[model samples]
Target: MTPAIPLVLLGLLDAAFSGFRAYAGSDARIRKQRFATRAGLRGLAVGAALLLAPTLTAALLLVTGDQARTYNTLAAGGLGYLLPLTVYATAVLLSLAAYFALPFRASTLAVVVGLGPLTLLRPLAIAAACLGAVLNGGGGSALLVGTIAGAAVLCVEPTVHRRWYHHVQ
Candidate 1:
């Protein structure tokens, strides 16, 4: 419960980035055809995926290990959250680099600017979300749960995009 907000934020970021990528990568013809309808479909699919993500993630984590049951003080959490934090920091740096490259690619900025960097950020975002959940939930077990949940969430946008792109059109 304590980690709920962080997890929600992570899910939101996943959907947003995914949606952006899909839209940018789509065919121009498709983008121009009933654009609003396609966008709405994408939104609905991503929303449904977001709701389903946590349940599947929780089930997978719960059945997989005993380590997922252990709680610890932040001090006791030790290296569990460390690696994730480091990865998240690296992602932030890379994302910054991508943003800096914006001016150079200004022409295509609207279409492809955020695609690679955002895709690259997915795993790192999961790591960051997991660490936040572990600390907030006061348990190392939350680390595993967070990891699975964040990973599950990462698929939301892409899955939605694929589904809607085919069906909505």
Candidate 2:
């Protein structure tokens, strides 16, 4: 089992990057300069995370040592960890693409932004990534539970956002 410290740190970094990207993308037109910087930083952060994933996982394994069951599970074990990383990476790319395309596709961006708030998406991504970490300690069932929970959140997020935004507007 990896120590809680590294996992918490990783989660914090993930959440920060995710939050930046979602916020920048959502308001790129209003703040192009800030959006560009944020996008660049987010790209760098995601790249570094992917590059160091193996090393970090190895280090966690070393720190934890090969003990009982679920040793080295999160980092080196299965698709559980990798899947969330991939999802996050893909989301970053897609969000950037959408931001870039927003000017040419205002309707599309509007529809998307109208459907759900970008703010919520950021934390959802973080939650998914943390669930991936849970795979390290808990196992496949943890990943499954995370997936289900995430799906539930995703399903309900838009309605909550829409209602809130409607009132604000």
Candidate 3:
């Protein structure tokens, strides 16, 4: 499968985790049980919204000519290499958005916290992608992807956090 699919799914899972947490807060489980379905569905929506840029970027890249690409077949310096960087950038942007908008809603906070596992691995993912691309004799495209991905992932989080609060509230 394409690497993009997994990244987007990870985004979905992260959001779903947060959604469940939002509903199951400091209350009885039975009380919040009814909201489970709604929460899960909404989580998917939120995940889509949050990862829309990267997901769409991946789709666009694939449609343009990278359709045959898979993680295993990702050629360095090719358009396919951009997917990881884009995912990384999207995540960074979200984080930056949140950092700048501190003291957000607890639910939004929960979403941020819930992404802990994926967030932790993002750096490694990007590093490996970039390093592998370079070692594979990649050139401008790979470098460009890394630069932009680094910029975006480092930038989006805080922005999304601030904006997402308005939605959750």
Candidate 4:
């Protein structure tokens, strides 16, 4: 199967989980319990890893090129590569921590704290970058699928959060 398949499946699963949480009508506290399980952590890890793969690969290319002098993929003399790598790497690490390391409610809160502001900006930019990559034959379908998945998450999460928090207060 293509690499995009996993990303697509995970994206769909992510959306499904968000939808489940929305319809489940559980309070934020209880919802955190549901989402912070071992299984849920694994899912979050996988999804986060997938989401960051393309940008990481790009950064790795830059590192490898510097070490081996084989090729440099960091277009625009590294400016293009550095920006996305730095931003995405930071976001991914925090997202992993928020979902995997932190406790349930705190994890949910952590994502809000970390990503709430950049929710629209980051996902949209990444989606646009991925589309550009696909059109320019830069990354691949997997990266495109991942960007789409990330965008889907950004779009749906606020509603999920609202649903989760609705009964809390």
Candidate 5:
């Protein structure tokens, strides 16, 4: 398994959770509970996938025994390598909090507070993808997948927020 696959998967997981959070927080009572449950399940799945990824990748490497000389494969695929995922998760959490705390509807402050970190991290997502590609022996496909995943986050998050805002308002 190339390194890009894991990174892209991680990116997609991050975006999925982020989008869920954005969409789930708008409702009240039973709807909120259902949304939260679904979102939590998604998060758990993502976490499990991330935890398994390194071991799976290592197993594949052992099977293939392809010497892709770049960096330490184990280290590259390890938990520490998921810093980008963690950062993205943090940004999503912060955005969700900000979205709740700040007033919606024509409020630039709310949007800025909610999206600032995500915007800042957009470039970092690309950088992480590039790094993952490099570490995985120049599989540009992984980078492309990661980039697309990040773009999905960028697009979906705001739309989720806006939709929820409109619904709530």
Candidate 6:
């Protein structure tokens, strides 16, 4: 089993990146630059909180021995660990595609077709990834799967946003 420290560090990085993305994508801003700086800082704080909180909680749970069995069962195993990562990646990819193929009014049929697979396969993919990780063994494999998934998600965001803005206007 991988040491808890490294896993905690990885989780922290992931949280940070996710928080940054979330903040950058908020709808309240008119000028991207103006809000970007503030959002970035906010994201950093939120990410740190997320990463630290979970790690601390898990550590405490481990010490207390009163840990939630169900969660432990799911997260302790390799497959369980990978499932959520895979699903998250699949969902983000699908959302990106959906956003890019926007102007739903114009491409209603295409949008439906594109989103169809995502809607159906996202959950299954995540589940399978998690299962694969658990069955295969945890460690770097889980992180790799998650990184690849996150990258795929990132790739589509810009295109989707542009299309969405165009459609809105």
Q: All candidates' lDDT scores?
A: 0.53, 0.47, 0.52, 0.48, 0.53, 0.47
Worst 10 residues of 5 by lDDT: 70-79
lDDT of 4 by residue, 10-116 (tens): 45456444444443434445445555443334444444554465456544654655543412222322223224534654675577577778899988887677655
Candidate 2 residue pairs that clash = none
5-100 per-residue lDDT for model 1 (tens digits): 444554555455456555654555744646644654575457556656555654454566454354233223324444454466455446556666
Off by over 4 Å in 1: 1-3, 30-37, 40-44, 53-115, 131-140, 166-169
lDDT of candidate 6 over 1-169, digit per residue (tens): 4334443444444444444454443566576765555444554454455445445544554465545552344255434554465455555556556566767664565445655455455445645654565565443434344344433333333333343333432
Clashing pairs in 6: 78-133, 78-134, 79-130, 79-134, 82-130, 83-130, 87-126
User: Poorest 10 consecutive residues of model 6 by lDDT?
Assistant: 152-161
In model 1, which residue pairs have backbone atoms overlapping below 3 Å?
none
Score candidate 2 by lDDT.
0.47
Q: Each model's RMSD to truth, in Å?
A: 6.6, 9.5, 10.1, 10.3, 7.6, 10.5
TM-score of 3: 0.40
- What's the C-alpha lDDT at position 52 in model 2? 49
Which of 1 and 4 is the better model by lDDT? 1
lDDT of 5 by residue, 1-169 (tens): 3344555565556556555666564666664766765654554444444435434544555466555532344434433334556666676666767677766763456556657656676667656744654465444333433444445545545554564444563
TM-score of 1: 0.51
Using lDDT as the measure, name the better of candidate 1 and candidate 6. Answer: 1
The local distance difference test score of model 6 is 0.47
Error of 6 at 41 (Å): 3.8
What residue runs in model 3 are displaced by over 4 Å at the alpha carbon? Answer: 26-29, 59-169
Better of 2 and 5 by lDDT: 5
TM-score of candidate 6 versus the correct structure, residues matched by position: 0.38
